[model samples]
Target: MDPYLLSRAVSELGELLRVNSAMLVTAESCTGGLLASTLTDTPGSSDWFAGSVVAYSNSVKQNVLGVPESVLEQHGAVSEACVLAMADGVIRTLGADYSVAISGVAGPSGGSPDKPVGTVWMAWAWPGGSRARLYNFQGSRDQVKHQSVVAAINGLLGAVR
Candidate 1:
């Protein structure tokens, strides 16, 4: 992991937490619990970071995060709809002020023509609304996951701002 970049991300998250004075939650899939782990790694993260859910499977996404079955069937797990649902679900379930969600095909093998291995979908949800974005990072599974976590944090910072 890039310590400098991680440090910067942590600093930015801390700043956002200080300014907005709100807590955050994370719902993760392809990036697993990396986003949550990174946030919790920082000292005093509990002041602003609420908690996280690692919804890796479709069943978990639907059952745990309340992602609609229709949305999953229509858009697939890597789609914007699923990510948005993840974000919204985390915020609603955890009662956090904001939430970030990520889903992707970060793998050495799970690459379809339409959605490649590095294809990642990220979403950020606040009190009023939420939005999702797509990213195509080029790297190995670990690298892609790292990129996804970084992007998710950046999106949260932007949303809070």
Candidate 2:
């Protein structure tokens, strides 16, 4: 993901959210806080950016984001179910009009046969509805994370409208 393009996406999203008078929040996992940081990179992001929850561990996902233990156990953290739960949790908990949640296996290790490295599940929620996507990115750790952030931002842009 080019820094310029990412900045542009952030700016575009900020503008849309501002125009709609909506707030945004995030629940992040494999991409860590990259998505949140990218959104905040633009100046005056606070107008629409609420905050983010970096739920790197299952415990945090279950506790802070209110992801169900059954969801994690049955579908794993890198599943559509978990990301959807996370998306809804962030929006409900933070009182945001829109939210994005990401969870993935982005690493040189720690990938199962079912979920290879770069397998990411991202979900975006708006006031009325939500959507989720599964991505099989091919790259190194940094590249995977970058791709996730790009996709997450793009998803937000599409959903927030």
Candidate 3:
């Protein structure tokens, strides 16, 4: 992620969560723990940041976050269904008031005829509600991950508002 954009998003998210007295958790895959790292960069972020799970592997997603094995087999990892499950699972596993999950094909070589490279799916969950989306970002591996992180943060900000 760009330094400027990461700083802005982290600052905004910190303010929002502080105002709402809420905590956040992240479930990351393609972007690894970039979201968590970005958020934790802010001082006193621990006040509202609960925890994060870098579920980069399907096994971690299933065992740690409780994403159903069937869901992974049926829809693959970067699907709407998978991300929704991840969001719900992370919120429950980490016991956070709200959470975001990210899964994507961020690569220069993972492109498929259908899913393609840069295909990303993200989900945000709050009490009694959840939302998921798919994004086909165009870039190199690092760029794709950067875009996914930014979009995930933006989605959470929008969801809370």
Candidate 4:
């Protein structure tokens, strides 16, 4: 979650999308709009970054992103299945060439035995492919969020390339 490395990754992602003439969007839950904000921090990001959806509530995840109610019920937000659905939903909703979704519990309090604090799930979707991963980040809430955004952009670089 080093600031320099994070900025470098975001710059790289913007370059890749611009070079490919592709647009990227995001769906965020635990990270809120941090991912989108980071991308937009790039000077020319509007050319590549489409928009972001902060689907922090289950209602938004279901209504806005089209994440299935069943997925939430079965696996909860911090699960692979939920992230996959969220990624697909954002891509479809935003009509972007690529999409990244993050859902997690970045907590100092909201930890359960099953999905503890700092447990995060992320997914990236591009064209006909997608990837999902679980992360257990350490440190404060902001650190987990920064790490999530970094992992998400890195994941997009992997998929888009």
lDDT of 3 by residue, 1-161 (tens): 67887788788888898899999999999999988988898999999999899999999999999999999999999899999999999998989888999999998887788899999999999988998999999989989988988898898888777
| Between candidates 2 and 3, the TM-score winner | 2
Q: Cα lDDT of model 1 overall?
A: 0.90
Ranking by TM-score: 2, 4, 3, 1
How many residue pairs clash per model? 0, 0, 0, 0
Question: Residue by residue across 30-147, what tens digits does model 4's lDDT show?
Answer: 9989999999988999999989999999999999999899999998878999999999999999899999999999988788999888999999998888889999998899988988
TM-score for each candidate, following the candidate numbering: 0.95, 0.98, 0.95, 0.97
> Best lDDT goes to which candidate?
2
Alpha-carbon error at 127 in model 1, in Å? 1.8
Clashing pairs in 3: none
Q: Rank the candidates by lDDT, best first.
A: 2, 4, 3, 1
Residue 4 shift from truth in candidate 1, angstroms:
2.0
State how far residue 74 of model 1 sits from its true place (Å). Answer: 1.0
lDDT of 4: 0.91
Candidate 3: regions farther than 4 A off: none
Report the candidate with higher TM-score, 1 versus 4.
Answer: 4
